[model samples]
Target: MKKKQWQGWGPGEQAEQHYLVEPRALAGGGDIRHVSEFLRACGWRDRSKPGGPLLMDSLDRSIRIAYDPFVHPGGWTIHGKATAHQEEWTAILGRQAPVEIVAGLTDALTRPRSAHAPNVWAPLQEQRWHTPPGAGHVTAVSPDGLAWMQFHQDPGGHAMWWSGAQDQQGNGWTAQFTATTPMHLVQSYAAALASPEPVMRPRGRVPHSARIRTTSVSVLPSQLSAWKQARVTAARAATSARNSWKTNRPRTTAHPHAQRGVRAHR
Candidate 1:
């Protein structure tokens, strides 16, 4: 059987330029939408057959959902050391992993050889939740790797909430309180809203100093230490990996028929 490849781009695009490395499960790939193809990779769909019902009742079996998820007050650029994953029940489904696996995964996540330990999870206000300044139903696989969830909102209601959590290694999960609705109205409205935006000309040039200003953000010393430690661990791991590769490389011996130098020895 052919190996499945998880890709954000198709035949014409490159992943580096397009993808923001995802968090926590450790594979590097971009977010998936129109996941019919992704479903194929996961063996959720039969590749030889056409796609089937993508209905809500069909999804809830695996997702364990909740309605009216809470929205964060504002955009939060929170940076800190990677925090431990709590085995607490989810607000939506009250979902919790088994103690042993959860603990094992937690330790592995916080183990010695990791870096990039920031976790970002702030939901923008509803007005800006699903457009350019907002995120659409941010998609992710379930913790059990069984189903996909779209943490998005609808026109008449806030359909779902999605929050992303990641470890220092860019291993991440986008947890969601998802719901499905008849999206025809939303689709139509979006189509109408897709018209060209009005062009606005600036009245005059503002003074340079007023227009731009230098700013500094204060970070906790603990956060700084954590960030630095993560980097150090990553660097050491890279060096060790290089050494191992050199040690294990196949030896290149002299050719059997190669010419030999004639020298006299005392």
Candidate 2:
């Protein structure tokens, strides 16, 4: 009898995946007691189990208790079994409460941005008691999800925020904070550098010294070349000395014989 070769079908022909059966939705102000009943009816565990009812009950209660709107504004909640002993509820809840509260606070603080507009600027009209008088408005910048730079006021009085790529050669940017003359100049420079349009250039070559001015003298090319050559020569000499030492190393026998000859002559 000849053996058969099986050619397996590709992924598209594979059996569809399935998930664990989800708990049926509860109705009419379901609470912890209801959740425990449902789980028991579903044959999750027997009533005699240490955590069978109490554990499920507590989790259900936690889910039902209204989370601080400031923290869980989305109204999302979760319910699940915990592995710790039934008596461990006190410790678990104590530890979990602070963490949950912190998470809620963080969510509340950050939620406004996503729910709001692309760019929003809040100008400070007056300095508060804590802040100095006329201490001007500060601007913040954010890109993607989080803010990078916080309220920083530039030399100008006007306040605004900016975001995006870092400034690099041929891709520079500037921001303005005030409308004062100096600020205007800064804005001009920023606009000039940030414009997407290519910058116009003179066809002729400009002298290097004209581009940048410095009071200190710079080394001439000839001098720099001479210095480099001198360094190379010194390094070569040092290497030769090391090689010669290795080649001319005295043998132990030769040293002993020379010492004996010197003692005999004496």
Candidate 3:
């Protein structure tokens, strides 16, 4: 069957064209969770386990690599004939851009545009410098203007963020994007060209937890005793409070002269 134009998990025209149980696909469809399950059910393939439809993400990463050409940011071609792009970036999302590249790309992407003529001035933006989506370009150049960088933001919905750069010698390398995406991507491209292990290059704040050795954690005997004492004290205080409340409660006595139904003065 002809795949849907988009790469994401959706039935599209595939439902009507291929094997799909309409009622099951539509069951609990109002909620997104059930809807996706229903769509997966429509494309159920494992005949041995007919009831269990494999999840989209659970599909091997190789599938995405195969579909890389049709993937987003539309301009993967600019990075040359590399298929590792999607697989690599998806693995490295939270990782950071290198330190050195960050400074240069900062100057590039955030460089003030000349109000006189933005066209005359390069179109510099703070984050992923805009391209005609999926297209890559010379997003930034070095301070000395000796080197330049390129980046491609996936035109598709996936945030598989990586970009490439080439130096004066025409050597190129790849780098990942962090949450600090656009500027850093611009920076990482330049840095990647210079550094041999660009992807593994360390940058950004070291997490505090990384400094500590993790051993089995347990409450000390003294701590446990203190906790027990505290609980006992709390229980005693609650009982004391309850008793005090009952003792302090106001009491009423009826007088012979008072109306039968009226509450007697306390």
Candidate 4:
């Protein structure tokens, strides 16, 4: 099959191509604003200092988010501490990873939930990724052999899952999460990685690592711009709605009788 040329984003900084149904190979961290807005809505307070990494902490201080572009491997990190009755875990959605894909993990991490373990490999399996027989480590690789995901069971250390994608030129990126990371969060990542939706990128801006394997179709700049704008609009709308509710919500007052404690119930 004849593949289209990767039209680097043009001189106007417009999108040059759209990779259909792939995100792991997409260059750069995705729309991080979505992540920041989402965390803020979840009551995560931004503690980032000027010109530093975007650092945020949960209300109860059990979770933290760190997004640093300047540092390698520091990328987007979600750390969950073991409370008095809980265990600690960490997930790193690498710097080169797409923002939209990584946000799935963050969304799952922040949402309240009960404990449950879904088969994390189910998504990959359903997507037709293959696992080698008799492999010591659990792993699955895309049919094209360009992408692979795996989980390592380490008894003496943190059991972890990591996934990556690359081109023929040996350029690629990976994401990692510990076994203690919630199954749902892991599943969310698995699902996103297995998704068939194509990711849009400026043809010119494609990272060196993805160049060889990246075959993209040139798309209208507006197509990419509109997509980006839609996402921002949605996030802003959600924030506005939340703020409006907070502002317009009726406040409840304590009953005077209740305040009196009903004679101490003696």
Better of 2 and 3 by TM-score: 3
122-237 in candidate 3: lDDT tens per residue?
32333223334443543554332322334434557334334443334433334454423333333333443333221110112221222112222222334434554664455446
lDDT of each: 0.28, 0.27, 0.30, 0.72
Instruction: State candidate 4's TM-score.
Output: 0.70
Give per-residue lDDT, candidate 4, residue 153. Answer: 80
Using all chains and alpha carbons, the TM-scores for the candidates as numbered come to 0.18, 0.16, 0.19, 0.70
**Judged by TM-score, which candidate is best?**
4
In model 2, what lDDT does residue 104 have? 23
lDDT of 1 at 59: 18
Cα lDDT tens digits, model 1, 11-118, are: 543222111111112221111121222222222322122242221111112211111112332111101122243222222211111111112211222223334332
- Minimum summed lDDT over a 10-residue window in model 3 is located at 20-29
Q: Rank the candidates by TM-score, best first.
A: 4, 3, 1, 2
lDDT of 2 by residue, 1-266 (tens): 44332254333443222111101000001123322333333223322344322422221242121122234212212222233422111111111121212122212211112433322232211111123335354433222111122235567644343322221222211222222212222222223222222211111211122111222223333443465466445544654675678699886565788889999999
How much is 20 displaced in model 1, in angstroms?
22
Once fitted onto the true fold, the runs of candidate 1 whose alpha carbons sit more than 4 angstroms away are: 1-212, 255-266
Clashes of 2: 4
Candidate 1 whole-model C-alpha lDDT, 0 to 1: 0.28
